[model samples]
Target: MRYPAVAGMFYPSNPHELIEMIEHCYMHRLGPKDMPSLGCYEKPIGLICPHAGYVYSGPIKAHSYYALSKRSDPMEETTVVILGPNHTGLGSGVSVMDDVWKTPLGEVEADKEFVNLLWRECEIIDLDETAHLNEHSIEVQLPFLQHLEMLNIIKFKIVPICMMFQDYETAVEVGYFIAKIAEELNRRVVIIASTDLSHYEPQEIANKKDMIVIRDILNMDEKQLYEDVVNYNISMCGYGPAIAMMRAMKELGYGEARLLAYATSGDVSGDYSAVVGYSSIIVE
Candidate 1:
């Protein structure tokens, strides 16, 4: 089993404290301002959420999960495919770990069978856990899903993919095979693209750069998004995951995308001098 890597740092280590933090995020001024209900999920697709401390990105991250709570296709057997950027260059260029991921809330099993199937099909995919050991990008997303699980709003398995190499060619290829295999296996899925935008820039500069990246995401233009991030020199941490999710969504025949919320650490810290940008987006 993979244990909580950033338990006390990114979020609370105690279960109760973590639960309280999650509830507060849903009620934060920047968040949905209320808790979510057990509504039907009619069209399950993909989501883009920032991975940062609860104080900074939690409220914005809440927007994506809140939207998920609102709609999907009657949640049956489902798998959430998480794509995150590798902060520590520890393992494979592209890897997936087939182990149960534990958080303060509890354990969420990995779709080990699906993970293995995915490995067989894509030569680029690695079943390595080292890349995820100290990676906060993917770890921080669990509690949100766990919160929804505790609410009984949804039940799920996960396929966590970490990309050490975020080049356009590699990202697109990994995404294509993911969708292809899921379809072949007849697996129902919801994709999570985990990323944070424009690190430690002035609020104005961060906003400007992040908006350019978010626009391409909302437009579902993976190729254009990848190019813009490079050409514009946007320091988005997970552009590769964002592009991968977009490609997977397109392959599944889903089109429309929406920006749920966008904010930066400056909004909460009240320090506009420098901040990291965060955004919540959903594609269906």
Candidate 2:
């Protein structure tokens, strides 16, 4: 079984506290002030969320989750395939966990059948726990999903894939593999790519650099997004997952993307000297 590593740190360890934190995030809705009314769209197929602490990035992440919650009803079958960066540099290049994730709320069972399908489809993807054991990127997303489940907005399973090698080709391969599998299974799956933007830079610089990444995301240019981040030296942690999500959306005939929110830690701490950037996006 996989255990919570960042509990009580990144977020609350107590169930009640965690729920309250997430609720507060949703209610607060901190980020870009001039956001246009998020109109209805086709069923959400993917999301790009941040993985920072709730106090820093939770509000941005909430925008994506709240938008998705609005779309999910009790009648639909949803499976969330969460792809997170492997921050600890452990395990295989692409690690897939086949075990229950123990959170303070309860146990979230891994989708073994989907894991097996991905393992069979990709040589780079492996069934391993080392990457997940000490990683927070994937772990942080679970509680938000659990909160959604608790609200009865959506009941869904999860397939958590952690990536240590975030490269252009790897992202594409992973994305197309997921697209093929979902089609084969005739399932409705949402790919949630967890990432944080430029780290420890001035707020203005962070926003400028993150916009480069966000522009490609909005344009649905996966290769350009991947290349621009690397070439420009933008320190986006989950560009690989973002590219993969974009590719998967493209494969599924999704051509539109919506920018939900963007902000920096300085917005919270009131220290604009050096801060991490956060953003939330949806690709449909």
Candidate 3:
């Protein structure tokens, strides 16, 4: 498999260093001083996490994975389906992998049966491995799963979808369809919306914009979320995926969402002039 794009720049090319870094991040927890435990659930439906680098987004990422790990089910029964934005503009719709996705930590085998099943059901799906080649949106979340040991036992498959030519209704429809399949099959699946909030803006402005998006999302108001993005010109990297996740979570019986953590690149780099926002949220 040719792993192209931002391999060395976004993350370390050396396998050992990459593993060490992910492990280190896992060791350090992030969140409120009095954060409550996530506890366990039968089939936790969705997660929204940032896709920034380990240094900038690592703590927030840790909060996400740690919450996931706190769930009751053993790792073996969990199936992770990651939906991310298409930064490369290569794949127009959903793209599923036919083989294992290799990272510096190790290889994550694609659940071929599920991938094919999705393609058969969804008209907009395709088998395009190249779509994932250079996309850090999906890759950045792998190490967190790996460090939690969820990678080894979980019967997980990655569906790297790039939403294009689709509206909020389309995202809702697709999300409901996936939820129906999971219910019918009696499978425990987890959906992850890989995204970041506002892009390069002053810290204060970025915070304001991100809060608007977050409020809409927490209220389960997909239309308001879209409107806020369009009205404010908020450049959130994963708005499509976030909309889809909200739709799917509602279908799967989750009625509430809580913001787990929120921060920005400025918090890490100490630069307030230009910053990108990061947030971790859970649907329950």
Estimated TM-score for each candidate: 0.97, 0.95, 0.89
Worst 10-residue lDDT window, candidate 3: 29-38
Per model, state how many residue pairs clash.
5, 0, 1
Give the CA lDDT, 0 to 100, for residue 69 in model 1: 81
Question: Per-residue alpha-carbon lDDT of model 1 for 1-284, expressed as tens digits?
Answer: 89988999999999999999999999999999989777775655899999999988999999998988876433575789999999998999999999989887889999888899888889998989999999999999999988888887888899999999899988898889888988887888899999999999999999999989988998898989989999988889999999889888888889689999999999999999989999999999
Identify the superior model by TM-score, candidate 1 or candidate 3. 1
Name the better of 2 and 3 by TM-score.
2
Residues 113-178, model 3: lDDT tens digits: 677777678776677776777778888887667655533323455555656534677677667766
Candidate 1 accuracy as lDDT: 0.90
Ranking by lDDT: 1, 2, 3
Question: Which ranges of candidate 2 are over 4 A from the true structure?
Answer: 29-44
Give the best candidate by TM-score.
1
Candidate 2, residue 79: CA error in Å? 0.9
Off by over 4 Å in 3: 1-5, 27-41, 150-155
